[model samples]
Target chain A: MKIIADKPKLLTETPMHYCPGCTHGIVHRLIAEVLEELGKADNAIGIAPVGCAVYAYRYFNCDMIEAAHGRAPAISSAVRRVVNPDNLIFCYQGDGDCASIGMAETVHACMRGENITVIFINNGIYGMTGGQMAPTTMPGVKATTCIYGRDPKKYGNPVHLSEMLATLTGPAYIERVACYDVPHVKKAKAALKKAFEIQMQKKGLSFIEVLASCPTNFHMTPIEAMDFVKTQAEPFYPLGVFKDITKEEANS
Target chain B: MAKGKVEFREAYCKGCSLCVNACPMKILQISKRTNAKGYEVAECVDMDKCIGCASCATMCPDSVITVYRD
Candidate 1:
């Protein structure tokens, strides 16, 4: 008589608009589950960014704000500033939003050590815009713009956002987890839950980057996209906790 | 009697087949019938064989699958 896999109460009943096989919905569910588990669903404030997940405001049951592209970090920081200090505030952003257009805001927020959680979805393409090359796109990945495959010498290399942000002293937690497999999906949920926990502790800047699959953009079957995420993406964007200041604080 | 069960919100399934591939029991498959959303949805062929591993639910990006144990 136990409920095993019901939808999280924090997730709205609204059906998602993400493409089939897109991993954004899984991430959304993970975050919603975390919010419900922490008993912060009602107190949670989510900032939705412009990209594939722009409609996220309609999906999460908590109060949400639609922030300008790449400005999600800035708006989230401001929300964290004016809102009840103990309330949970987070940003849901894509690679193009967080690493490309919002790169400065993202980096600055981490530098300032803003006590906010950033759920970054790195699918390595401009998914909503028909699969263009993104800042996080792999060096040799083919996209609409990079039909010939990404060129390191011409277009530069993929930006390791988690690794870059981890170098800053401001972030209390940073982790990169993928959603292509069961074990990794479970790990992703754990990472997201830990990020929220860090925010609750008033630990500054918790960033979790999820390497998601884009089957439509990748022009591959859902299963093949999962394989691509494992074989190609993981080699470039290795998974694991990049930083956890709570551990450092405990050890010290 | 079925030992386990799984239900798919057909309207939400994008017919991605992730669940069909993830099901270790090999009891799930894409249905020929499309849902209200016009995408083929996943369907379990044999509820009796389900182990309740929930792998289909875990790999479903749409969160359309829900599993239950009896």
Candidate 2:
């Protein structure tokens, strides 16, 4: 009980408005844990996107900027260049904000080797926009936009963000993780912390995409949602650190 | 210490019985009452003997268990 209160320096005393069992809360906790671990809460600046985490400005205790739909990378770039170089910059976005609307900005930001960490939440459904299908929406998965399930013919196949981004010549690190359960959630925490560490090393841009759950829109109870994500979604998305500047540094 | 109480939020549980059999105390039984989602769940009668091992929470496919330790 005591440990919970003193947990993270990156979050505020205000409670989250996200629905119960929504991975937004877990994902927020992971970022806070990273801030506390790195002792950068004082100098850290976070950008909140226009999705479910748009309310993140209230939850995260660090200096936060609410960006337009999918424009977090652009905002982060401005902050990283104009603001203190020693300051840690971070951006939080969902699939719609990152993979779809912000793809152009995100890709360009990474190619420029922007020194920042991007926390991407891939729930496959547009949570804030009423569960519309997203670029990462799995094939055959039903969404509000795709009443008959996503089809590669019309909608095309799901975009694999990490794999695609890893092909880029810039980003210092790129990883994808899950927030569905304890083990996977812990792995996500470690991955987020590593992204910050990558940034600290001036290793250029780092990205971490977390597979989150939209229980209300997914039409699943909490546990059922967990099961669906673990068994069905994990096989499709997978999880791993695709690139590591430190590992590359050790070799090259 | 007597028995501890196990509270299950049926809405949060996914009907996975990993907790029902995980209790080594053998004091747990499945509840006949179905939730709004129509999942047959577990109910603990002899909570007095519960050692608070949290085996149910660990084995619980759903993280809906709140164990009160005595």
Clashes of 2: 4
Top candidate when judged by lDDT against the true structure: 1
List clashing residue pairs in candidate 2.
B2-B48, B3-B47, B3-B48, B3-B49
What docking grade applies to model 1?
medium
Docking class of 2: incorrect
lDDT of 1 by residue, B1-70 (tens): 7667898888788898888888888999998999888998889999889888888888787778888986
Residue-wise C-alpha lDDT for candidate 2, range B3-53, written one tens digit per residue: 456677666544445466557888776678777666676788786787776
Candidate 2 lDDT over A1-252, as tens digits, reads 011222255666564556546777667867876788788888889999998889889987888999999999999999997997889999999999999999998999989989999999998999887889999999999998999999999999889989988989899999989866656777888998989998998989999998887888889865677778888888998888898878887998
DockQ of 1: 0.71
Q: What value does the interface RMSD of model 2 take?
A: 7.7
Q: Which stretches of candidate 1 lie over 4 Å from their true place?
A: none
